[model samples]
Target: MKNRTKELLREGKRVLGTWGMLGDPTTIELAGIAGLDFVLVDMEHTARDLPTIEHMARAADVVGLTLMVRVPDNDPKTILRVLETGVQGIVVPQLETGEDAARAVAAMRYPLNGDRGVCSITRASRYGALRPKFAEYVESADRELLLVGLIETAAGVENIDDILAAGVEVAFIGRRDLSGSLGVHGAAEHPMVLEAQERVLKAVAAHGRAWAGLVPYRKPGEEEWITHDVPFAVYRNDISLLLEAYQNGVRMLGRESASAHGQGGQR
Candidate 1:
């Protein structure tokens, strides 16, 4: 399958995706069919566990979507377990320092450079059966897999420079949690939050790395749209988008009903 996320990032286009907190395999398959660049299987906030995540990853792969899992923390065991499920990428949350980011990279790579245990029969290795020219497959897997470090806390912001220097390919800003950490909870539009975002963009840009973030609004402001020089943008989650569309439709129908009743009375 093509790694659409990596392709978009390389082409410098804005890759769009949604959060998959609802760990249902059918929901993931539906999102893939909807033509999203990727879907983040949120393990941190959702009730999803390893087995369910593995199934969801395979479902996404079947539909040509790049599956990325947001690991709960920078735990090596969690990283190894998810990667073995054949996910294209891993997003490590609460990354605060260069060392933390490096550790994530280590967990993704094999030993001699990292501590990941070798397993030739895992789904990532195509169940240990070679398709002729197996070495090529291993090389491609190493090159295609991504390591994304999520910067969400005040301390993470303080150490942003070091994190980028650690060679993480993508630095994603967790806007909701970031705002709270900056003492401006739910104020993503606050000047403080905006400035923090700017700093993050600058640091990542300085190192020639990719960046991504979430935008609350459907129609983003000019700065929000451009800031971070964001190559990939995760616009919203499935549940939130569904709720918003449903509420809007209901409100519009009510307005139309009131207008029609008034016109009838006048006639």
Candidate 2:
């Protein structure tokens, strides 16, 4: 199976994604079939546990959608356990320095790269079914595992260079958190927030690493981020989409009913 997320980035293409915060495999499968390049399993703000994550991963795999998890934090055990669920990548939030980035990468690697306690018999290794050739599997995983560092604060933006040097494949700017960090809470498009984001994007590109971020779902004429070389984008979330669809339908129905009532009275 191809790591569609990284593959698109490597090709200099924008990869579209959606957030799977509902802990439902059905939503994940729907996203995959809808042609999303990837789904971000949001463990950070959700109640999803190991079983739920594994199910989501399986659904993503079956439909050819690349799955990545935003781990709760940089905790070693949490990182290792999530990776073992066979997700192709991890998004480590709150990356404030080079050391933070390094620590996250270490949790994803073996002793030579970092101290990740090894267990050949896990979902990541196909439960040891690929043994003997396990060395190759490990090497392939090392090369393919994407490390996405979330730059959510002013300090993280300032330390972008160090974060990049510490082996992050992609630097994702968390606009909401960053706006708060800039003291313009919720104003992701505030001048100060945009400037800080620009700085981080520039630094990430200068170091030959990729950058990712969120954009409002189909915000009119908002293609500048891609033009600026952000390859990964989370367009929206399942819950938001669901709510929007229902609300729009209700509004349309109300308008139709009012129009019918007015027309009948006139007749």
Candidate 3:
């Protein structure tokens, strides 16, 4: 029943996290140690298995980081697998309409709100330890566990109002993918992309739901999300950060070597 990410949002505090695309528990642990509020394990674009998510969720729990996972799609079975691991939130990708968002919500909730299959013998129910208090757990999980919808397409932008009405607690409009959907490819900064982002986010905020975005490292454009009053941001993924670090090291060495050669006068 502990959800630090939701608590932070309720407390009017900024919720910062990084993507866990590497499928390593250590990365989730490191994010927790680094003071992140959550770690969103990526299953949409990664080879992360269900057991890997369970392990990462375990690491996140130990470190007090709220564990969230992006399911490959809005499938009940997919959502069920992660929830069993005691993960606190679910993110459904390529969410395009209210029906899609509603389906995702129903996949996570227990009836009479949703139809998610029940099993108290799972980590989320304390391996049957909370079996006696299963009803309470169900209520708490339904009330607190976040249901996030990813808006990454033109259709999503057009239907944002409906999406919000469908009970998506968080609307994370992914600009990178939205850019591609809008025919901009990698131009997340294109006017069309930025315009659609603002449109969807404005609707998300207006509907009294939290909004999230991916902030680019060292880009002034990244600050727009903050200034626009977004409460959640994922500061790049672990893989991207590592790649940048390595690339920087190589660039530094090359610069140093070039400078030394210039000073040596063609030696």
Q: Pick the candidate with the highest lDDT.
A: 3
Candidates' TM-scores?
0.85, 0.90, 0.90
- TM-score winner, 1 or 3: 3
Candidate 1 is scored at a TM of 0.85
lDDT against true structure, model 2: 0.84
lDDT of 1: 0.79
lDDT of 2 by residue, 131-221 (tens): 8887788777887888888999999999999998999888888888999998999887789988998898789778876565655432347
Candidate 3 ranges beyond 4 A from true positions: 216-227, 253-267
User: Residue 190: error of model 3 in Å?
Assistant: 1.1
Score residue 254 of candidate 2 by CA lDDT: 67
Clashing pairs in 1: none
lDDT of each: 0.79, 0.84, 0.84
